[model samples]
Target: MSPFAMRRRHAFAAGLALPFARTAFAQGDYPSRPVTVVIGFTPAGLTDTMTRIIAGRMGRELGQNLVVENRPGAATSIASAHVAQARADGYTLLMGTASLAINPALQPSLPPRDPRQDLAPVGMAYESPFLLIVRADLPIRDLADFVAHARAHPGRIEMGSSGTGATNHLLIAMLAREAGIQLEHIPYRGAAAALTDLRGGRIAATWATPPDAMPLVGDGTARALAVSSRERMRTLPDVPAAPETLPGVHGTFWQGLFAPPGTPEPVLARLGAALDAATRDPEIVRRAEESGVVMRPGDGGALRAYLASETERWSTLIRAANIRAE
Candidate 1:
């Protein structure tokens, strides 16, 4: 064949293989390298602890390591912003918690980036209810009795929280609203201080996660009266669900896996699948349950929906309570 004819034949052959090549590249071994999971809290914190648990199994399922990186500050707004600004390549992700949804409404200084818009929810990891803990000597025994006492006492009783706009604060505010009473909510720099006060009989109550409250309850330092979940927590089955006495009060320290915005659908699907599988793993469930967490495994869309509902729910209470960051 002539030179031009030979060139045309080669070009045609290349074109024929181009589509297959593109397909292969698109479907290439995703996550050929390690993926980093970012948490907005310090190590050993609730968010970090759960992310560490689920990310390991997810890494195994994805055939790559899932590294847990801590960037705790500004009530997780800093780490959340970091993940929100990261490249949309599935390699960077956030083990986002309820704080991500709650912070925008709570922190006036936090430049607004709707988590629903800025980050891609990969999947739900797990959720843990806040236990309403009081000093063991307090007459409050269960949620109903607590509500009645708060109603009778009004602003006289003190309710403590981690911070002014924290989930614990929002939960207590919601409880106050539901009971038609006023609680003198005292905000602290950390749960430890609030818990310490509760143990010392300085504060009436504080909303605490299982990790923070269960130990105190176990040692008779505090009494768990109720859990802020719609239903009973399997780990704290003896405690009544707050919603039983006050309907629609389901506040939890829920967490979801997230990626930066614009991450491709296929990458998200893979991560979500691995997450769903790993979160449901029997050992993962057992570990999380042992820590008083309820394993919730779902897809990105479900996570998005959950975030939306949580944001609305928490924001309304924060506004109603006039909650602002300390």
Candidate 2:
């Protein structure tokens, strides 16, 4: 080979390699500035509160602020779409809830039509089951009594939920199917409104998160009948798990961290590590336990698998029950 030909070949190879090297270097320097985590619910709700708690810890690990912003609407589709369409630079993320999986099956027209394809799973944040509570004044004493009462009334016991197609609402439908009872469903704008009606005795029952229900249960305004998880929670040891009464009836409200699709592998790893660390933090675990939430620290692959399973589970139930978004 001539000297001139060898020189040309080396120069061309370097030119092609330069761009690839630069891209890798850029991805390595992730989160050069503050990162924003968008929440799909209003501030002070269980999702918002848990996101803030975990974000604060993650910020310390990343050495950058994880600014949380609320964009509550369309059953969380607005926030999901915003983050899904944002730049995949690890700077903007979504603290997606179980609604992420439920909405796609429940409402096919929503902005984020396919979560697995639109967003990159960063990691699993936390999971907690819903609490089945009824008005304290009701004669219902436990899950058995509640089932018998509903069977007796048959679509007369008004059950309130955050909204139609919400996780808690789906649990209500699942309970009715599994227990072979019919209950009237009353949808509200949010859990707080449903809880308010339950407190006033306008609604017979509703499913609530521990954080939201504890205040009323503690004061004797409402009585907790059962938990929707597969097993009893360590914090709420006395509440019977729903599966004991009706086999195969279990559901949970879960949160997972996500980035826009096509995010760099290095960036996803960095973010996932921060999330795993945050969930395992001593204080975070303690607070989660106190609130009856279970911390599920896992990597992007784990989140992807979990999301797929949840989507399948909810989709089957939604279709079988003919659940439509409100």
Candidate 3:
């Protein structure tokens, strides 16, 4: 071939590859700016705290700031919707919770772009069991006593939850169904307020996350009846699992990170790697343990599988209990 002809052919090939090279580079240099993690619950809650901790470590790992935005309302559907509509870049993320799975089952009329359908799991951060607590003055002492009391005084025992359709509320309903007992449910704006009412004896019991329940139980204001986990909590070993008496009942709330669907696979993998590292960090693990969260890290595929199982489990409970958004 002539040298001039060969040079012309090489130039054509290079020209064709420029756009593809740019696209690949763009993916490789993701998060050139800050990343925003949208949390579905209110600030200062367990989810917010966990997200901020993970975000700080993740920011350090990525050498970019990770901003946590709280959009707490509508049973967490508001924040989730925001992420679902966000650009499918790594910039937008969701601090997904057990509510991510429960919301679809509880609120069937939510919208076409549900979080379960619109968001993709990036990684899981931690898991924790909710504690069934009652005011110290309450006569009930254990799961069996609580059920007996509820059965003896149908509609008289009032239980409180952060809100309707929340994981706490759904778990309570599940316990009720499985125990063959009936209790009045009181929905509060948040878990803090519900705890206040329970302390005041206005409510008989509440399903509280361990962090929230631990302080109350420690102060002698409330008694933790049982943990809603398959195994006992390390910090509260004396307290038995709720399933001990109820037999086949078990539940826990999980917190994790998610991205809008269509996020590049490379970015997702990078985020997952950062999360796995964060979960294993000594400080992060210690802080989570102190906060009553079990540090459990899983990659994108494992997180997705866990979410699918949780969705199915909650769906069955919701249908069986005829639970719907209030």
Quote each prediction's TM-score: 0.90, 0.90, 0.87
Model 2: runs farther than 4 Å from truth?
A: 1-27
Best by lDDT: 2
Q: How many residue pairs clash in each candidate?
A: 0, 0, 0
Comparison by lDDT, 1 against 2, better one? 2
lDDT of 3 by residue, 31-77 (tens): 68999999877788778888899999999888899999988777677
Model 1 segments more than 4 A misplaced: 1-25, 108-112
lDDT of 2 by residue, 217-268 (tens): 9999989989998899989999999998888789999999998775666788
Q: Select the stronger candidate by TM-score from 2 and 3.
A: 2
| TM-score attained by model 3 | 0.87
> What is the Cα-based TM-score of model 1?
0.90
- Residue 89 displacement in candidate 1 (angstroms): 1.1
lDDT of each: 0.82, 0.87, 0.82
Q: How does residue 220 of candidate 2 score in lDDT? A: 94
Candidate order by lDDT, highest to lowest?
2, 1, 3
